[model samples]
Target: MLEIENLHVTVDGKEILKGLSLKLNVGEVHAIMGPNGSGKSTLSYALAGRDGYEVTQGTMRFDGEDLRAMAPEARAAMGVFLAFQYPVEIPGVVTMNFLRTALNAQARARGEKEIDAAQFLKAARAAAKTLNISEEMLRRALNVGFSGGEKKRLEALQMAILKPRLAILDETDSGLDIDALKLVADGVNALRSPERAMLVITHYQRLLDYIVPDHVHILADGRIVKSGGAGLARELEAKGYDAVIRSAA
Candidate 1:
């Protein structure tokens, strides 16, 4: 559902992703494991069409549509969802209202009827419950004073309600405890469908255990150095990225 070819991204005059190419097909979950400064998050931002992530070269297409030409909101409306590693706190905006507005906005953008308030509230409540989000938390300002786990769970809740075709999770496992991690992973796994694709970017292999990916890729210095089946992640866990990167080199 997503295609990126020879993508070179520059952030603040520094080239991050150099000649990176990846294609995620429908009904697949791909894990990208890389060390720090390897441009893993850069890839996610570029795909989400975030400003300042200039695509200096190559092309990014989402389901045959040019992503580079689309704005961030347009990309989100086109079924692209990004779960940030550090979710920002939007003070004064109630979480439930924000979610409902976002969902309905996407629906309207797609030329579909907006969801009724009653229907939206029911769906949102169910999703929040599945993610272990409390009613009080939903009534609070978006991500305001939330624990890291709570913020991540809210991200998953948004994903569940929106049902994006391509979900880019940028370190969704970060700052999660064992229990919180399991809850978040379960939420993600529940969204897996024949028409959905997920790109999971993480540093540790522990996250992979919960969300088993169809393929594992080793990204280093802004490009994918190796691609393999699920075993590749275990191998990286065993030998470390240094050894695997050296061997791949």
Candidate 2:
């Protein structure tokens, strides 16, 4: 569903991603594991079209269209969702209102009729219940006064509501407890289907235990150093990234 070819990204005139390339197919889950400063987050920001992360070279195609040519909102309308590592709090923006607006925005872009208030509420409530989130939480401002786990849950809630074709999770497991991690994984697993793809970026293998990936890729110094099956994650945990980096060198 997504193809990134020779991607090189730069921020503040400093290149971070050095010719990174990877391909993801619908219904597949790929996990990217790397140490700090290995350009994992940079790849996610680049793919999501975040500002200031300049694409020095290479191309990205999503569902047969050039992603680089599209705006961030345009990409979202075309079914790309990014669950951030840290969700920001938006004061005065009610959670339900923000979610409804976002949902309708995509629906409108797709030429589909917008969901009515009643229908949207029903779906949102159902999704929130699945994620163990209370309706009261949904009524509050987005992420305002929420704990780390709460913020992550809210992100999952958004993903569940939107159901984007390709979900790029940038360290969703970071700062999450075991229960919260399970909740996040369950939310992701619930969205898995033959028409959706997921790229999970994480530093540790713990998260992989919950949302097992079909493929595990070890990223180092801005490039994928190794690609293997799920077992690779366990091996990396056991042997550490130094071994992988040494092998790549």
Candidate 3:
């Protein structure tokens, strides 16, 4: 569903991703493991079309759409979802209201009618319950005063409700505890479908145990140095990234 080739991204004035290429098809989940500053998050930003991460060279196609030409909102409207490592707090906007507006905007972008209040509540309730997002939590301002786990679950709730074709999770597992990590993973796994794909960027393999990626990739020095099946993650964990990088080299 997504294709990237020779993607070079520059944040500020320094290049982060150099000649990175990868493809994710529908019905697959890919895990990208790399050390800090190895361009893992940069790859996610480039995919989400975040501003200031200029794509100096490369072509990204999302189901045949020229991904680079679309704005971040357009990318989101076109079924791209990004879960940030640190979710921002919007003190003035209730979570429900924010979700409502976002879902409505996406529906309109896809040429579908806006969902009604009753239908939205029904969907949100089920999704939130599975993610352990309480109705009371929904009434609070977006991510405002939520615990780290709560914020991550909120992101999962958004993902489930929107059902994006391609979900880019940028360190969604960072601050989560064991139980919270399981909850977030369950929420993500519940939304997986034949038509949906996920790119999970993480530093630890512990997240992979819960998410169970279909493929594991070693990203070093801003590019994918090695790709393999699920066993690759376990191997990396046992040997460490330094060994893995050298092996790839």
Candidate 4:
């Protein structure tokens, strides 16, 4: 579970998120819909404790702990995962190697012993298969020369393997074709459980068709202006964000 209270964030001295607040409970799925420059991505980065994005005024709590005081790695170790919109390409970093390192790092932080190579391989292989990613793909450099869809699938692979308690997907549906989108959505759906929560950030309702959220939120000008049920998503898609914004206004 996670809670944000009056989250006001700034980047390069420009305010982006102003008095934004939301609460998510375990096993619940929420979708954040907004127009461009609505500070959706900023909220994700700020919640993830990414550097450079200053949290001028606000408090973010993850499972009752103050997330603002913790480092990014600490947040990740505490079961917070952020699926980035643009997955960076890291040449010379084999996908498997990077994954193992990340998994081991989190495990160690939690005082858990690192998994053996054989066990890691078995789990990774199974997860990759579920995501329709081949071992050959995992053997290559991380995100290097991979298609947009491929990168998104790789993100899902990581998510499945990590099994974070709270996952924040920042526009994972962007730039994905129908097939790729479905694959990613399936992966997300497969990971949904009573112990986890998800915040899906997207502009279109098409992705919601696959991952139907329990709640829908409309964010505009750095604040959540509207909150509704699944029907709100359909209404927004049918009429566009202008209607929602005007109605909220």
Answer with 2 or 4, whichever has the higher lDDT: 4
C-alpha TM-score for every candidate: 0.99, 0.98, 0.99, 0.99
For model 2, residues 45-80, the per-residue Cα lDDT tens digits are 888899999998999999889988889999999999
The positional error of residue 198 in candidate 3, measured at the CA in angstroms, is 0.8
Once fitted onto the true fold, the runs of candidate 1 whose alpha carbons sit more than 4 angstroms away are: none
Could you tell me the lDDT of residue 123 within candidate 2?
98
TM for candidate 1 is 0.99
lDDT of candidate 1 over 88-135, digit per residue (tens): 999999998999899989999999999999998888888888888999
Candidate 4: regions farther than 4 A off: none
Clashes of 4: 0
RMSD of 4: 0.6
Give each model's whole-structure lDDT: 0.95, 0.94, 0.94, 0.95
> Per-residue lDDT for 103 in model 4?
98
- Name the TM-score of candidate 3: 0.99
